[model samples]
Target: MRSVYVFPGQGSQHKGMGAGLFEKFPELVAQADDVLGYSVEELCLRDPDRVLSQTRYTQPALYVVNSLTYLDRTTERGELPAAVAGHSLGEYCALFAAGAFDFATGLRLVAKRGELMSRAPKGAMAAVVNLDEERVREILTGLPFRNVDIANINARTQCILSGEYDELHDPRLRAAYTEAGARFVPLNVSAAFHSRCMTDVQQEFALHLAGFDLAELTLPVVANYTARPYPTKGYADHLAHQISGSVRWYESMSWLIAQGHRDFQEIGPGNVLTKLTAQILKDPLPVETAPAPQPAPAAVRARPRTELVFMYGGQGTQYHQMGRGLYDTDPVFRDAMDRCDAAHRATAGTSLLAAVHDDTRRGRPFDDILTSHAALYSIGYSLTEMLRAAGIHPDAVLGHSLGEYVAATAAGALSFEDGLRLVTRQARLLQERCPDGGMLSVLDSPDLYRSRRDLFGDIALAAVNYDRNFVVSGAGTRLAALQQALDAEGVITVRLPVRHAFHSALLDPIRPDFLALTRDVTVTTPRLPVHSSMLAGRLGTRHGWDEYLWDVIRRPVRFDELMASEFTAPGRHFFVDLSASGSFANFLKHGYAPALRGAPAINQFGNNSGTVRALRDELRRLAGV
Candidate 1:
């Protein structure tokens, strides 16, 4: 009575696959939407044919639906399998089911893998039936082209060849396979799967996987490349390399059979893997022999509890008139600001307090008050230090966009002086790279800009804040074109006051220089947990300050993902806004309503000592220390 769960790979996708599942399970839909930052239902059901078939959409969509199906099946009955395994793309689903990586990490990895795979040379795949594995390999070995190879060895008499289209069409190779008594059927696939053509992508994806923590599989999960159980260590690396390696499906099934596993359940869209398993088994049993399902965890009941505190702030939230009243009312805050101003002027060559308040440059705009790199850095330092002096400590810290440096300083990864210095230098370098172009905040979906490519063809949606809100930036003409297009659609677009296209591809030129500046800076690990907007998740031990700060400029700011992951933890409460104003706080309230569940009591400490004191009292009361 031994049983195992198996997952399917790329070609298992079809239109209208997960529509019914989303309808039946609304919570699963919401979870998938939050993780993907899009409408899961729209992607699964309503896509206009080819859109769903794209590599990026297809891989993630399949993974989501497959994982959800597994959940649903297991929840319906109370039976857990003794082991798990999957084909190429399905290997991630296996690891996720085994708890090696969480759902979000798995989704992100699959998405990135799909993106990299799409960039490979356009190729195709073919299924060779009624052929021995050794004979197919021998025939492929004599091929004239260097691109072709045996991709998936599904059964003893079946294998799939993946390579370039031209190589697949080679008369000599096709004739050799035909002569070897095999039936060849070409598959409708883009890019050669499980071939050396994917080597370049495999290398990069390995580095990405290094950032994740890979634990041993709790269940006996077979590997597609080695056709054996996963090793406790280096499973992530193994999975990455499996991309370009041959999928030993026959050998994997043999190993499972050796382990006394008879019944197999393929819990995903399509029965591709199940059919393959049947073909491989010596005596194919009825599909009814599949393992019984398992019951799900009890539904999480909504409870009103508040304990965790998330502090938010960053550089851009500073203003010239900020802390004017605080300086008069609170001596501690005034002294902290004074110290910050002196240190900042020494390193960044600017008076931060003057920039935030009483900027006497006539005819200058209000945004220009703290627009300088030095001014923003100094204000962030001063504000964070003021909070610390007022005795408020957060359980976790998240910074939005430029606020990461402030969060680093708060976490003790970067000293206040060093954080200010780095921020000032980084800001000045970015400003120098693009002096005129600015960013525009558009209150519309990024898909709108992507869909209507002709209207704002030149403009790039730099930041995807949420599904319906984004920040578009480029040259003035391009920005104007995009704004006009949105206006025509009855969407209001607001121009950001900053004078740089912050996250656009235009900043690519400046990244190398910025990386050079960060090379010599000392970056220590943070005392508290810090989530990165660049990586769209919590920072792992591998991501030190040096790597995080340098790449922050080049990578897209994934603040929306951060909010979704951080606030979803149970009993989490009190997001403390550490910036000069409540800009980020407002974003959280509106963008993350589902995660926060109706605003879990915000504490806006906008450069004021009274607000800081109240937050400190709340923390002390909650902690009871």
Candidate 2:
């Protein structure tokens, strides 16, 4: 049973925060007093000169009390936590607890840190509640917001913004957030402490930081910048960047959850960190006005043994510049994408990276099946790797159409290089031999497609995503006519970006060539359970995988059939949608399955890294982590 000791930062400071701890650790308090050049106990308990709330005094005082509290608790318990973490100013105390530095040295450092941060330029910080990072980013991106950056991502819907005071308080800005169903509350701070506004302060602090040598950590200390364990070297760089960079508290906790840390103890004055920890570990729910719900029977409904299924979506879910953010922000995602790109370029003399990032700066609707097919495989495989790196392993895999190749690779039925080759060859065949057509998404029952012959007589049913959502493929003229007729009937319809009518007669000409290309490929039972789009249930001990693979694209997708069978099963199951646009999760959200829940691996909005962290936390809670 591993655990983490979390320490709160500046905002937790208050009068009498160190009441009993100061007396318990007299020697340490004395050392802190001398190092800080003031009575540590007095500033925390009395604040006689009213400087305790000031940044300089507040930091040192909080550090002393937090360290003392930690020491006292560990001595009484006869042990230390398996790991330690802290928020902003609390990081120094965390490092001290991990044996990275001595008490006096830590006190001296926080004192200097406090002094530098206190001298920062006038700025503002605001806590925006009830809006996710993606939605908040969407709101801010539309406006000309200068110097404003997100300083802290505390939870799924809570974040702190640090920037120029005027920009944060602009009447139109606050009004915009308010209109979009968010509450923005300004924090009492004078400087944009963890933003570019603190660059000058960070540089000066780095000069001071160069004077001391940090010791090797005795235990893991998750970093705020990387949201993972700190490396042995680069203490100065990590610390310097932290001063002027956003605090990824939410991501840090998500990483901890991935590491099998289920218990978190907040060793500080207030319960802010405790509240945040609880929020991060719990499943997010909407506010309801129905009757009160009964308590869960944890013993009867065990989640620790829950099954995890990774579901991958196919085309039309992708947009231009897909995965661009994760590529730039997450090293793990970048490495995985780079590997896939290398394989892609080696085989086809092309780069999925170019498909994802075009010369128009950002791309538009990318419908080139040659590139989109390969891109889908690359993204699906890369996301699986990213999730695995965060300790999320799929008990089974589900792939739709082109995504089946990725699933096959994940399940050990196909080699990564072989999978890439097959995908590119299939894309090429479809481009050369198939008729010009497209896919249309209809928001209606599958039965409607059968009854309305005039509308869908010539089109082929491609996929059934859920009870009321399905896709049809055919020539462009027929798709347009169907979309227009559906729109007139108040039926929601969307034209998918595709070049050919997949799963229809339009693609029959390419089957011979596609089969010939894959004739020499080996197919076997997957190491992990696979529920494919063409199958009614899990692929169990089946042979002729090559034919099955071909049928996966040529046959209509029966995702709803699989969902219908599995969602009603008795086992504890969690679906993790590894789609670029989160389409599968959307289906689960609306389907009338009892207590069915799912988490998406990526988002179309510019927050894939953070979104995946949120997904980890969300799904971890379901697995009883």
Candidate 3:
């Protein structure tokens, strides 16, 4: 049976939506609350005085409720419909169902959207019915006022015009619209929605959306503004542009009907779209006065339970004794590494692998010296290749500071050769800049340091893992000065291993050199999804290889935030940390334990055959191959 699921726009929210569902499905409610960092039930059911009625709260609240309802109802049934569509704010919900945008990104976009749209000037909306579409358009075109335009066309006989309150209240214009065979009814909306009044709001919204890696839709989604289907690459842009454009709802509905889809289900909050469908289908067709009623609604089905395999790498995961092993064992890994080594020499004016294997440091152990940037990149290259051979693909990838270069390689934005070159160059640059200092991971927020600013003078909080977990990096003399000051306040700090202040403004100087090196390189789009620690979102077209390499040096690592968002989805989500040691994997598990429990499983490989075999098995299991 042909059927489509449609979502409603704003003005459909109620006082106690999703309350009953939340009570019945506590797990779903808890999942959503964890993602949003608030009690979903409280936000949906307890806004007694309408404080939640504001656009920011209302849009997200409705979307969460609608999504949960869809999931619940669908789980109790059999299969999704053939098509999905939504009106304005509801379009995100439709995209989620269509697999265009995941739940977390959709919710985030909606929240940001509401906040942006709230900035629009206050205005009014009025529905004009029983009017010809052409004449209504002609009247609106003739209006001499700013911020006034057609908003929604519910049917061939109805349309909504929104604009300034004073302009809408003009007697002559109202009479002109009425004289053209239509009835005008004022609406209760606070601002004119879906009109030029919201032009500024739409512009800001586009910038935020530009950062995400939006994939193609697996199913068709009817566009609101154009009343047509849009390709995946431009979906986000189309949705943002629709904010100030007229919503051709009537045209959209007619287009669907013409496509031979007779069965439609309104899936969120209210049955507004369903009611409109009934009205649109009331008249008999030319062939018959009455056509057979559409088949019963199809049952909804839940997605399969996929295993969450977390892969960790250990210190021994390093190989020195490594380059030859990869060369002999896998051609792909060896070729990639060879190319990387060549790039390293070309960019840094030295052989990176030779530097990594060199044991000439005065006081440091050979392994310690080898584990520097050059060595790390070589190991990262080998590990990623090994995983590919084992058939292990990640749904999401995260890495600790140094390990992030590995994740970038896996995501395809950076080739193994390019990664090694960049890492080698970065390590040399950093070591040269700060030859005698080290970083300390303090378990405190920046606010703590800020509150007692005098006590932590010179020693700045480098990274914020969470409220209580932080990393502070500075020179030894500065650190000593700050430690003496903090000692008086009874606060202690732990020193991290190795050297150099990472993820601090102190690294700013590296930008110019890094940019110069990247200016001559050709960067391409990522083949797989990769989150940016610097941007706290998936890397976009703007972050092609060149920009990413430069940003890696200048920006603060933000993998923690990326991990936080990844764990928000219900059920299993895989995370692979490509490093020589399991250090990054352990850090992630400990740092995000609360969010990790819902994650299905965790795995690690520190240059071991057994771990490699296990990773292969897990990959096969997750991919059902």
The lDDT per prediction is 0.67, 0.79, 0.62
Cα lDDT tens digits, model 3, 1-625, are: 6578888878788777776677766765666666667776787788765756777778888888878777776777777778778888888888888787777778888878888877778888999988856568656644434346678877767789898777777787688888887898988878888775675677677668778767678877877755656554445656676777667676676667767778988877778888888876663112212221111111211345353433322222343444444445567666666666777677667765665444454233333322356666666666666566655555445444555566666666566666666666666666665444546655555457656666655554545555456666667677767656666766676655445655545665666777676665544544554555554444433233555665553444445554443233333455555555444545656675544532212122223445445556655666677
lDDT of 2 by residue, 494-529 (tens): 898787887667888987788888886776546776
List TM-scores for all candidates, in order.
Answer: 0.52, 0.51, 0.50
The candidate, 1 or 3, that scores higher on TM-score is 1
- How many residue pairs in model 1 have overlapping backbones? 10
Clashing residue pairs in candidate 1 (N, C-alpha, C atoms within 3 angstroms): 74-294, 75-296, 77-294, 77-295, 78-295, 79-294, 314-403, 320-356, 320-357, 321-356
Which lDDT value does model 1 have at 313?
A: 48
**lDDT: the better of candidates 2 and 3:** 2
Scored by lDDT, the top model is 2
Model 1 vs truth, CA RMSD:
16.2
After superposing candidate 2 on the true structure, give the runs of residues whose Cα lies further than 4 Å from its correct spot: 1-304, 359-363, 541-543, 592-594
Determine which window of 10 residues in candidate 2 has minimal summed lDDT. Answer: 286-295
Q: Which candidate do you rate higher for TM-score, 2 or 3? A: 2
Candidate number with greatest TM-score: 1
| Best-first order by lDDT | 2, 1, 3
